[model samples]
Target: MKKLMISVVAAALVLTMAGCGSKDSGGTKVKFATDAAYAPMEYMDKDKVAGFDIDFLAEVMKEAGLAYSVTNTGWDTMLTSVQQGKEYQAGISSVSITDERKQTYDYTAPYFESTNMILVKEGSPIKSALDLKDKKVAVQISTTADTLMTKIMGGDNKSLKRMDNNTLALMELESNGVDAVVADIAIIREYVKNNPNKKFVSIADAKNFESEYYGILLPKGSDLKAKLDPAIKKVIENGKYATVYKKWFGQEPDTKKLLDQK
Candidate 1:
């Protein structure tokens, strides 16, 4: 009888240990990394992170019945932290979904569309892509804007000034350090809206600029994508996405058009 009791207790302990191991996977918490410097997408609001992406993800997590935490990992290391270091389960920092990135990282369905724009001070002569020839331009290094600018004006051009982030690039343009700043249209528009004193205008090259889609970054073969992609679709289908869209952008999103973009 003593041996039977011991075996039963041992089985109970094994069951307990198994339960503990599965706790986190049972939809309790997910940790995420993000670069909170990109406004209207993700940015620091005092000690807290706030923005369109933050709010959208919050809603998605709520719908999926999971608690989450976000760490403000800088843009340069955000992808590496998830893909190689395995530091976080996923990342969402307006990361563009490109063919190159797909090889190394898994991504949720594209959530946002973006395009490059050339931002110039109120009276700058750089009105178009052609006008940027031999003119000093500021852009965040390794960004889509940098890629586009390099293609427009050769990589050897001495006029290209690469900065670490969009804010710095815009600041350089404002200070007359560069003739113009090339960055995402949404980011430049948000900055200009908030800083009325610093008059900045964005010009788009309709024929030259290619639109890119943004997606959440996950480790290759991550099961998190299965959870997130469906949640994203649910948010769009239930009108929650439109509410968040209007809150940040001051207008409703073109639901049909954006959803159809792939």
Candidate 2:
């Protein structure tokens, strides 16, 4: 999720890797695709891609000494493009590393931790995931939130409303089309912070939503993992990772927990 999504329509962009602005040793520049709808993770800041993931990717690419560029693409496009390894070599829009995805893509070491959160208008009776089992809930399609809610509400649950991205899911809640919107905690929190007038509340249900890790995604069998893992580890050990985390999250990350998952 670029912020859980981590798009419905994404305009493509080609940008130089953050920092040093140098090319990889092989000089073969790579492309990283992402859905830039999830705010605070990746989003369109006017025309440029801005957010934590954009900043983190700059650090990872610089550490790996790889030449790369990130583009704004829809969620499905990011998944399919990275899988082909032709137009896009990798992706990093807050993508969760799951057993099913590992079969289709190679993931760099776990970099961040997240879980689905329930979002509702203030004063709503919905307090947790269970409360939404029979209530109309909105979620972005193909995201971990969607998958988790499906398991809890059943795949055929009519109350489960799936949107193309978190933005629309939140909109559904704004218009009272759904009882709640489920998505990554970061996306839920950021939206609430940005829309104080909306009076939204985010609920964390540890009992139903398990913690998950985020990783840089690559095509199955892609060799990029070999270069990225060490670079990602170095950033965490040296405190750069925490610096970026603090900048965006306003608090120190559980670096120890993140490293242990690697």
Q: Model 1, range 168-230, lDDT digits (tens) per residue?
A: 988898789999988887788898889888777879887788777888889999988888888
On a 0 to 100 scale, what is the lDDT of residue 72 in model 1?
A: 80
Q: Write the per-residue lDDT of candidate 2 for residues 1-262, one digit (tens) a residue.
A: 4333423454555443333325555867778888677889888787678899888888888888887788887577888788889989999888888877777788999999998899988899988888888889999887788888888899998889988778899889999999999989999889888899988888999999999999999998999999989999999889999999999999999989998995
State each model's CA lDDT, in order. 0.75, 0.83
lDDT of 1 at 54: 84
Query: Which runs of model 1 end up more than 4 angstroms from their true locations?
Result: 1-27
Candidates' RMSD to native: 12.7, 3.0
Kindly report which residue pairs in candidate 1 clash with one another: none
Q: TM-scores for all candidates?
A: 0.87, 0.90
